[model samples]
Target: MNSGKSLKEFQEKLTTSRRIVALVGAGLSVSSGLPTFRGSQGLWKNFNMIDLATPDAFYIDPGLVWQFYSWRRYNALQARPNKGHVALAKLSELDGIEYITISQNVDGLQRRAGHNKDNLYEIHGSIFELRCTSFMCNFVAKDNFKHPLTPALQGTEQEYDVKSRKRSLHEEDASISPQFKPIKELSEEELPQCPVCKDGSLLRPGVVWFGEPLPLGPIDQVDNFIEDEDVDLVLVIGTSGTVYPANSYVDRIRAKGGSVAVFNTDIDQEILDGKVSKTWGFKGDAAVLLPLTLKPLIGEL
Candidate 1:
């Protein structure tokens, strides 16, 4: 609404732009059958994402942390790539357009949707990935075959869409503290070990938790991409931008005098209008909106 430009006008602007980038978030995945926080039916109903997703919380109870992520992964696996993801991938083939993507989502749907790995940067890490925890272990992004949370994590898959509708679009707050049930008690003998170090402390899911720093390699890659590229278009789809590094990517790109286009249902108009000037904010179900709006920009999707 800021520019009041029609979708065609926006598309023309993008077509003529030399450099383009997109920063996608959880909302982009919702259409693919994933969930976002704050919906009335969100997965965090009895719990808060922050408390269960931080290093301090994991240290307090790794079992609980693992259970939460395990549940997340299970549901993520059930979802397929949606139109939004497919559209972004199509942009990769457009000529004269230097496009790059940075995603906060840990789910691997973007890649699964057919986006080029060379152009994508998964900053938060992926649930399909595991890593070694020992200080001396060099193991990174290892594939995890183990399923630790079976019973408690099973029911979530059935209610994925139901929960998404319950998520309140306006409940997100950067300052909110996440609180979840205590982790199930497990014997020290039951914990997984580090494979690379052979110390039995091998951690699972090499993601950047709530209080942890993002992967330095990918972080630096994103930094270099933004700094070196004279970007013209940035599409921020489905993220509340609540977290720091993930949230900051949009502002950083904007500071360089680039245009932004936003797609999400949860964020309020007041909040969005204040944050971006050249941004185009689309409200309502993103999954349904994406195919209709971006089909022209990205063909055959």
Candidate 2:
């Protein structure tokens, strides 16, 4: 209802909950100066995400796909973890609390923010990880964070500003474009390759593609954690709450008698008004709200 009362309840939940899970999304990283995939300035002009982010896209033109991902990796590499990430990390450090962050984002900021490896799950996989596309080859490891692959271009790194794209979205030429297109049509050898595979299958981004099944191990671990522990609270952060499996956790936790709290830019008043029974909603910038709400629990205020 009132701001004072809502904050008091949030602090109470933070202080008393033993098993708290944070369902994180792209909005959590917005303050880190990264652009989300769904908005107006998202994709490079004339390059549909559907045409560039799938296995079919990679198979048809690996060079194009790698170029797009290279640009993404370069941007993600440039962004440092923001206050929201720091706040979530602090939640895990509470003396007796067990906090798990199941992030739908692949940007790797949560891990970069110093969240514990044991408590964090990047359900969509990370951009820094490269895996062989061959169904048979089992080569997958952390990439060296390489940018502007030598074979793809023969000059200093090209400059591409996301701000420019945002500006373009408002201008007469509303199509967002980046300067990181492949310099020339690259052949098979020019793309990233699996060193272990004899047939030279290319390595693809380790993200979960449009139709790909989520990695089994992490999903199983999340399910096991919820089933084994008596979870009391779930903090839904920045997600649109649309994707399957990860999105289903909210209802799953509620079925198990856990309460839900949401932090987002646009929170529905109905959810906060007891329509969902034990749910609370906090609306605003997560980078600003999270630290203010969570830091006091650690006596850091």
Candidate 3:
């Protein structure tokens, strides 16, 4: 379909729908000047994402993980939200729309753009958070400001540039940027105590990482929301839909007879063959597609 025609139809459906759920991906943040995690632009050349994100890495050396995360926190803090983020946040304020944002991205841009806490879910863990090391500790709070730690995590210094990696995917020997540092080392002095149990360690960011279970509570809540009501449509933006549980949720919504609208540069052609019925896939640059596509709807709302 032509871009103009496709955008128009998607707009029509959106304006008429009352219950809309948006499954957000890292692509949504691309225009905001941040790279998608584990993506073509997100892969770490020197270190495996598995090593950097898993419990084993943190256990083997919290300094490494903390250092890696510290850089991420600093970078995310510096980045600004683009049009897509602002558009989604605007949707939340619309009078007739019941918009629930299900974002796969760990970046907190969506929240920073002012999407309501209750209306959105960050399925992956956020970079802006730090929970207590003690699982028993209930000291969960938003943390973006912390001092740099020693022996910080390294993901290859290449995390800063978006162009070099995309242009030379095969030949790049990117190293973790040297400037990044760790937010904390979990030392006795810096660690915050659990709010519920004073002796317990404070809870950290609640993001789901590789080799870990996606938070059951949020997943279950999403499931119940999709199943109990007649959801009008699903807006999947900026995700490759490569991850398992998060990827699988799209089909669950489809099985219940919901139509999907995808905005991504990497959508699989086979999935867009209408197996899910009336599914729409807009290719290339989510920052460009999502804002233009949703503007017509958001404007009318």
Candidate 4:
């Protein structure tokens, strides 16, 4: 955590940077009323997110998977972009600055924040988007926000203390409540299907699942941006920095003589320990930090 003169110096560096990139994660959306995918509150009833997010899970039980996604879509649609999202969007509007936001979040709040589609890369894909399960079908479309595709499958809403337990949103196993009721299974005919496929393949969530590769087109664009430009600064916002490729950007940018600054509620200790060169960690909510940090530079405070 750089402060006083060091902090001022970093701000000046940011104001003068020719190229800037923002690598955002789920934490950025927390203030927008969404839960982090890795937290205890992220659980849908007693369902483990990892179990529900995998291709195998979808293949085994498409109805249960769609039920989970449908709930996520409903929650996401209820959320609005937070100030951090708006501040980053404002950063992109700065004259003479080449900026791009590579987002790990699929909520699409960054796009809703007025970030240009051309300048934004949704690396994990978007919840508002859907694609055919049959990769060969190649059918994809923006979802019509039709949540609860099957009303019969919706779960009863209940509240639990998130602080009571910190469940793994990844692969770690956690106990499911004994009282949990399984999702009402819908037949294949009741599930959403690919509009273009004659064989009636079901549509799946547009997110990058546990073992799935990221969409190549966006990843290539991000790789090209880093390879071709001398990035002056990289802003890491609200991410755990655990996932690969997205997390790998920090090392790649640092290797190119770029500086990194992170605005996070939970700061990565490695950055504070000087594990990366020319790195600074600002510890706080990004909604507060981003506005205060970039406002003087971009007038969005």
Candidate 5:
């Protein structure tokens, strides 16, 4: 917990800051019952996320890849935006502040929370979007939230409770395995095909895969904001600040004399103790912390 004085200082800075950026990550969605897609918690049907989130995996087994993404799509849809997301959305709506939320999540929770589209940048492409696989075909369908995208993907969404001992026991029995295995070998004809392409090429999720480059448009927008404006404050919410490019923003903002307030469950002790200059770390569930911390901006404090 942050001291009242420290929190007041942060609130004062937030209120007076001219340009603000909220860099969001997977941690923000964890409160909404979404997985971070890391370590044991990220395992789906005993398959590693690294194996399923790559272009090579999709090339070798598009059906399996699609099935994995279909399951994720279903789960993302089922999750409601948490208070953390709502807080950022509300912040984006506030007048007289140049605010932008650069979210790495493709789950669409920020949008669902009513964040302004113009100010919200989905740096990583969204799962709800679909694009043709063929390089020559320029086909894209945005905001396609239809679950079980194809009939072949029906009932493919299986929830595995990694923490449940009983579920683990059931999964050990091969005979008792879910009836969705044989469907993994679905042929291209049974998968999502591009409507615009005459040859009917497969359509994959618009999300950026492990080896793929991020969408240029969002990247450019964020870059323009960073380059054009004198950033005054940056809210590092629910992220470890490990990944590149997005992680680099903290240093960039700090270099420009901007203050940083991190909202996460696991923040560094140095940051929490105010040992780091111009940074404040509030350790806790961001869903709970954000609403309390940003209350002043909403006239609640």
Candidate 6:
């Protein structure tokens, strides 16, 4: 079958599928002006984003970690949900069919797009949320969209020009080299403190870092959805399906005989040719393709 036929078949199946899930990733937010936490765009002042997203990094320099997250929060706040997010949000609201979105993105675009919270599971946690660092204190604040979360974080939300590979400081010169970029070492008191902690333990971004277990609540929810019934289809959007647990779901659903439809910028020609069994790959920006592909069910793209 050709790509056109595969898409038509996928759309036909989508209309009648009783159970559906969408696995979303960073690519979905790329069009919304959010950079993926990889590649040159992911670099922050001579630091790979992966290096800054670990517990050890936080342990060594909480202020630095907070600054990185504060920058992300600021960017996420500035970004609006794109068409892909809107389409998925609309799909979540459709009656009759059971649908869920398992998102690996921390940018919260899905929620900002008005996706149903009950059906959406943010596996990576949200940048807008904050939690107490102290294990003794179980304090978690949701929907804390306040940028420069604290006074210390003020003016720390510097934007990186990916094309030029330069840092654009709020009040400083935009042409500053990354090596000479002045590092602001904020004291613990300057960082955001947990209100619930008696001794004022520092609060961390609610995101799950490398080597940390995913939040049990969302994981359990996704697990239940997959185990409960036969999922008719899984719309794999934007993600390369690289990470564990989240990536594992695609295969798990496939094991239960679910069809897979991928919307991405880069896809194998064989998959697009419909040579892959029960799989269809549409190569393009998901923001553009998703709306068109889901238009049949949504009515009026």
Residue-wise lDDT of candidate 2 within 221-243, one digit each (tens)? 99988889778998889887867
Show the lowest summed lDDT stretch of 10 residues, model 2.
153-162
lDDT of 6 by residue, 1-301 (tens): 2357777898988988999999999999999999888877978776788999999999999988888888889999999999999999999999989999999999988998999999999989998889999979899998888877888788778754334544555646664554434458999999999998889899999999998999998899899999999999999999888679756999999888999998888788888777889898988899999998988899776
What's the ranking of the predictions by lDDT, best on top? Answer: 6, 5, 4, 2, 1, 3
lDDT tens per residue, model 4, 1-301: 4466657867888888999999999889998999998768757777778789998999898887887887788788889998899998888777788899999998989888898788899998988888898968888886456765555545422133333556678554465543455466688778788889999999887888989888899999999899897899999899867679867898899888999888888776876665656888888888878988886766855
Tens-digit lDDT string for candidate 1 (46-114): 667767777787777776566677777777777898878888888776666788888888888888889
Q: Rate the local accuracy (lDDT) of all candidates.
A: 0.70, 0.79, 0.68, 0.82, 0.88, 0.88
Runs in model 4 lying further than 4 Å from the true structure: 150-182, 268-277
Rate residue 84 of model 5 by lDDT.
91
Cα distance off (Å), candidate 4, residue 18: 0.5
Stretches of candidate 2 off by over 4 Å are 153-183, 272-275
lDDT for 293 in candidate 2 is: 78
Whole-model lDDT for model 5 versus the true structure? 0.88
Q: What is the lDDT of candidate 3?
A: 0.68
lDDT for each residue of candidate 3 in 1-301, tens digit (9 for 90 to 100): 2356656767788888878988887778777877766546454535666568887776676554555665667677778877788788888777777778888887788888888788887777687766667755546667454434222223322244443434445544455354422233455334333457666543344566668887787888888888778788888888766567667777777777777888887767764554445688787776666667887666622
Off by over 4 Å in 1: 1-5, 38-45, 93-95, 142-184, 266-277
Candidate 6, which segments miss by more than 4 Å at Cα? 160-181
Candidate 4 lowest-lDDT run of ten: 154-163
Comparison by TM-score, 1 against 3, better one: 3
**Candidate 5's error at 86, in angstroms?**
0.7
How many backbone clashes does every candidate have?
16, 0, 20, 0, 0, 0
Ranking by TM-score: 6, 5, 2, 4, 3, 1
